[model samples]
Target: MSLSKGRISLIMNRNIQKIFLLGLLVSSTAVFSQIQEERLILNKKREPEVKKIEKKKTSVETIKNYPPEEKSAVPVEYEITNVPAVSDFKTSTIQGEDLSPKFDSELQKNYFRLGYGNYGKFLADGNISGNLQNQMEVGANVHYISTEGLKKEYPWSSKQSSAALGGFLTSYGESGKFNLNAEYNLIDYNYYGIYALQPAADVDLSQKTNQFTVDGYYDFYTNNILNDARVKSSFLGDKFDAKESNVSAMLNLSKHAVQLPANGITMNADLGLGIETLNSEFAILNKNYSNYFNADIAPKVTFFSGNSYVMLGSSFSFLNSKNKNLLTTDEVKSNKAYWFPKAEILYAATEEFKFYAGVDGGLKMNSYASMLQENPYLVSDQVIKPTETKYNIYFGLKGDLNQNLKFDVNAGFGKVKNILLYEANGLFDNNATLNRSAYNFANTFSAVYDNGNVSTITGNLQYYPLANLTLEAELNFASYRLENLEKAYNRPMVKGTLGAKYTMLDKKLHLGFKGFLMSEKPTNSFQIVETPNPNVSNSTIYQNVENRNDSVAGHADFNLSAEYKVHKNFSIFALGNNLMTQKYETFKGYKVLGPQILGGVKISF
Candidate 1:
């Protein structure tokens, strides 16, 4: 009975264990199926679904994968992400901004100046300008200056007035740049080169001149070539019944063909061509018409090395001149061609030392208008010609002692053909038969041409230890020889200039002083001496005689000026001329005004 009960209990325990194991397996399978369904739903939402399509009667490559098609299903709730908004916005404010410190940017479009002082002196100057869209500029200016005669008896008063209207245009492009300018000027001048040797009486001498000018320039770059072109035209008219017209054109082209990097050298080939024409008409000089035409071509090669440079060039120039004398009904024509060779070399031994030498020559055209402009005292009776420069050789040394100091010394020898010079006429030859130019006797001069050679030496020095102060000095010495003249008339043997400028109070106050000196120059003069004629008793006759001097005295001039600013746009200025009260002569006998003082005001807008 005990063995039977033990077997039954063991059987019951086995059954219980089997039932528990079956229940646990069933629960685990249900949990795994639920977890798999949730994972499938999550993957469907997060990952892109792909579908494979089967093609009929195609190879393995024919099978293609396509994205899952859109389908409508029950709406499901999902967690939404929260993010911040982004924007690109800013805020700024400007109050006053201290524009005074930035006043340098302000443009001075207009300016005016007026002054008056003793000796009945007067000055008026003004200009107005405007910018057009930053591409062009237009402006107008007017100037007037006058001074009454001193206590002397001779006529020494003068008045000058001028007005100018101009415009400038510039175009900048990828290719290069172009500039255009047009200007018109009306000027009035007085013949004040008198009162030397005490004239018998005052003479009326005043002249009015008008000028119109137009100029254009273009600079272009293409590949390794640079091209430049310039054109200029001018029309000038004077009250002395003189009219002149001038035109000029120039073209320059250069190519940088060869360059050696190993030796640090560059070579450039340049070609230049120029043409000019001048026509002049003068009614006072026996009715004359003069025309001149000039053309030139230049070819050059320039070599630049580390510290040495050499330029080799030659110019072929052609000139044609035509002259007609209406009074004599005579016509004359002349044409010629000239060849000029140019060479220059420079060697920089060191940064502080340089040696340079060059030879150059050119032809200079002369016209009625040009001669009158250079010498206002020139008489209306004049002959126009072109000057030829045969050759000029120069050598110089220039260096800097320091950043604040610089010095230059140079010497040159040159020969010029048909050089123009001015000589006073009718010193004492009042008679028509005795005077060289009887038609021009009253405070007038004539132009004389000569062939001469000149030797010149010059020295210049500059010093600027401070930003506000600058000092400069220049000295020149020249010796001249003519074909058939004893001395070079009106040419100074020694000349020098000393100048100083200082600015203070932030450029509000400016001070300038200049001193000029010229050594004794050769000049011709005549003095009337009365001698009793042997044939005629007690009869006195005046004759012209050239005065011979053992020594000719030099002259010196000093001028000083200052300006004080009361405001940024306004100032008070003063000028003191001939401070030493030296009665010095600049041109033969014309003495400058002595000890003159002028004060004025300046304005800007």
Candidate 2:
């Protein structure tokens, strides 16, 4: 192409510009290469060195190339040296008396005791028990106690003899165990009532009683549950011209029914049946013979959770009584039904504290035998009935204070129906007959029934300061509200007992002391006197006198007993009763025995 001089110059200028541009590009490329090389060098310097490992030679080649160096044992020269050893020990021979046979308290099973006291009291007791086989044990016990009157002229002497035989059998299978027991008791007591009115000849105002009891139990167990059964029967006879006899029997059964939704809680049931009869001949009362029968059934649900427990159930009972008139021509029959609600709850707040509450009620049979045992100065004319505990609600805290101490405080409230009470019986005479017979005109007490509401608060404590020493105390306070009576007879307001026991010389000697106290209570006294009645027939009318002491002073008794074991099988004991107490009367016109001291020897095998 042809171009002007200016265009040619422009073309040359353009070629020159292109050359400049290419050179600039080459310069930039060189600078970039240098930068990359410098960066790679810096990276190589920053990274740590990684050495190359050489491949191991074959076994034969390695052995030939690296020959093992030979080693020889170096002989070490020993220098003779001695080190003195020291010890702080001395040996000596111990000399002691040669005790060929060790005395073991656990080996002694049979025991006998004989005692005599200043009040012409005599006592004899013996017990023997031994293993018949690996799973059986048999035992027998006998006791004879006799005491003369505190005063020779009082004509009040008591004697009692009792014997018991028992056996226990254990089975390895589901049939758990069996317990059988039999007992017989003979008692002789005198009715020295109304000392001023006793005849000069004393008339041998004594009576005899005989009691026999048989008890049997059978246990069937699965795992750890106790669903067993038992039966007990007892017979009592009072020799008041061979007229009084009492028979009682009871049967109990328990079983597990179902499992609850929660763990460890179970539903269970229990059934019981009881029958009692009292046959007596009393000339004073229109009804002389009575028979009582009762049956009870209860179904319970027990809930046992961690640190908590509860039991709920209800009991149903049926009672029937038949009374025959004195003339043996009229009969009175009565039947009743009772429902008792029962519940118990316990919560363990801590390892050492437990709080418990419960509500329970039941029927208690009051029979002639029971009354006579509680009060031996009772007349033959008595009423047999059942006491109904409508409901008893109680709450308590019981736990261990420490390793060696324990305590409990409880309070309760309840109402009892047809409660038994003892009251003096005054003499009665009709215009046609002059009643001077000892059996009819006897100076004794009788059982009376009344209703009452009671409230009680109690506390118990036990302390063991030493392994062989223990101290205990209990206090009880009770209040009563009677329905028809002015006061609750013989029901103490406050009662307490303090006791301590100590064993020294490796159980060779034991000392026991106890103190008892009770608050004052009411007592009833009665008498009879003849009054001339002009309006009535010319016969002397007999008027009854009744007196009641609302506040009979309480009594305190301190008893101390000590036993020194001479040998493993022999012991000497001394007992002091009423050691530091004044003369007191537990019942009206009946004084307790004076201070008594008794010494005895006991032997055990």
TM-score against truth, every candidate: 0.73, 0.74
Candidates in order have lDDT scores of 0.55, 0.53
User: Which pairs clash (backbone N, Cα, C closer than 3 Å) in model 2?
Assistant: none
Can you write out model 2's per-residue Cα lDDT over 308-394, one digit (the tens) per residue? 667788878788888776566867898999999899887869746878888889887777666764565676666667899999898
Model 2 CA deviation exceeding 4 Å by range:
1-108, 152-174, 195-198, 223-226, 241-287, 327-329, 428-442, 528-543
Candidate 1: tens digits of C-alpha lDDT, residues 1-605? 00000010001122221000000010011110000110100001111111111111111110011111111111111111111000000000000000000011121236677877655666665556555645344455454545553437244334444455555555544555566767676655455544223333344456677878787877563413456688988898777767889999998876753686747787768788999999988877556778999999999887877656788999889998898876666688889999987888878686456677888888987766566544555666567778898998898876554335556677889999987776665543433222222123335667778899989887766665665565767677888889966776666788776667676777677676666666876756545444566666766544555553322358675667787778878878787666777655545444445566778887877
